[model samples]
Target: MENRLFYVMFCMILLLSLCSSENYFTKNVKGEGVLAKNSYVNHPPNPPIVEGPLVGLTRKAYQYNLTLIDPDNDLLIGYEIDFGDTIEGSSCCPIPSNTTLTLYHMWYNPGVYNVKARTKDGHGLWGNWSTPLTVTIMEGDTVPPVVHMLKPNKGLYLSNKRILPFPMNLVIGGITVEVEAVDEGSDVSRVEFYVQGSLKERDYTTPYSWDWYEKSLGRYVLTVKAYDFVGNQVSDEIIVWKFF
Candidate 1:
């Protein structure tokens, strides 16, 4: 009876030691005294670097090198460039992280423009804009700014080429109208948002966007018109069905 009691006590002590060791390891691995899965946080990319000519001739294409680095080591998919002509340009192609890309642009007229750049990572997060580079154009031409609708259109449905009835985009709640405007010559002055042929709002800055809330649910035509510094204009429209 005495030997059996001793064996039982030894087993109990061993079990307690094992449990204590497990707890210690677990706490060390977690670094917090709790048992939980580690959460991942995505960091945005670093500000982009725009390198090009500080002074060039008008209407002549100048090469600019754009370099971006993601803090989380994510892949960079695109770039947003503000040419300081009041126009912005974007590239939606994926490129490796921490790499330099070359882009070409020309000024339509002679002016001192502050060019800046930013980047978007694969996770759809945008970084801050870089320091501006003042560029002086000698002589230039004139062209209308290019505009396009970006939001409210479901990505898969619109890009897939699947034909639908009246509206190309389907929205269940209030939607935001986002636009991308670019000009090679003159800078964009303003972007106008219209719904069902009526002007709703006008944005005079980069990342032109307007939030639209409609009580009634139905199909509506959304239009975005962009005007350049030279009074040149362009517009793009999209049809959307808003329902519950």
Candidate 2:
């Protein structure tokens, strides 16, 4: 009996040692589960909605992180962010308990992207990729006169001729742009132009005309804004570069 007791005690010690040790990775298993102390499951949290074409890079701390959520709470090794098309960001493991993903901008034209949080414990069980979160670049740019191109559409604006489709730079084609002006909350309306790129003009109204000049050539984009009688406003861009 004494020998049997000794054997049981030894086994208990061995099991305890294993439990106390940190867990490195838990593969295959997923969905609503717990991790042993020092253990990690997989991946990171989801991404948020972004606006604008490039959401201009900002110097802000937008911590987008997720929890490993393993009861063992093992010592995680590191992480990586893969934003499609070979775009990637990474960090060492044993991730900061309060770590978050930092981004230069929140907006993109239109597409899907994701982030990955890689964690490794002292164990060799490599965890699977984190839950992938997809995001669609915001498309809510309602500003009017939506300038469409960088180069003017035509060298000649002949009367009674359907103008060719104008395009915008730094953006994909098929975007809508318009111009209009009106009095404050009144029906009165009119349009004006202050050409500056290649032509010199101070103030003028719509249905304006200009002569093409060979001397004036290189780069030119038009910016126009329309206002309503009630003092409403809209803006757009136009590129001028069509030659006869």
* Best model number under TM-score: 1
Tell me the tens digit of each residue's lDDT in model 2 across 1-244: 9999999999999878766778432444565445456543544322222222222122111244445433244444544445443444444545533334344333334455554444444343345566555644434322323112223344333332325553432222222222343333333233333234333332235433233333333344656544433333554455644332
For every model shown, what is its TM-score relative to the native structure? 0.43, 0.28
TM-score of 2: 0.28
lDDT of each prediction vs. the true structure? Answer: 0.78, 0.40
lDDT of 1 at 147: 86
Cα misplacement distance, residue 126 of candidate 1 (Å): 0.8
Candidate 1, after superposition: displacement of residue 14 in Å?
A: 20
* Candidate 2 to native Cα RMSD, angstroms: 15.7
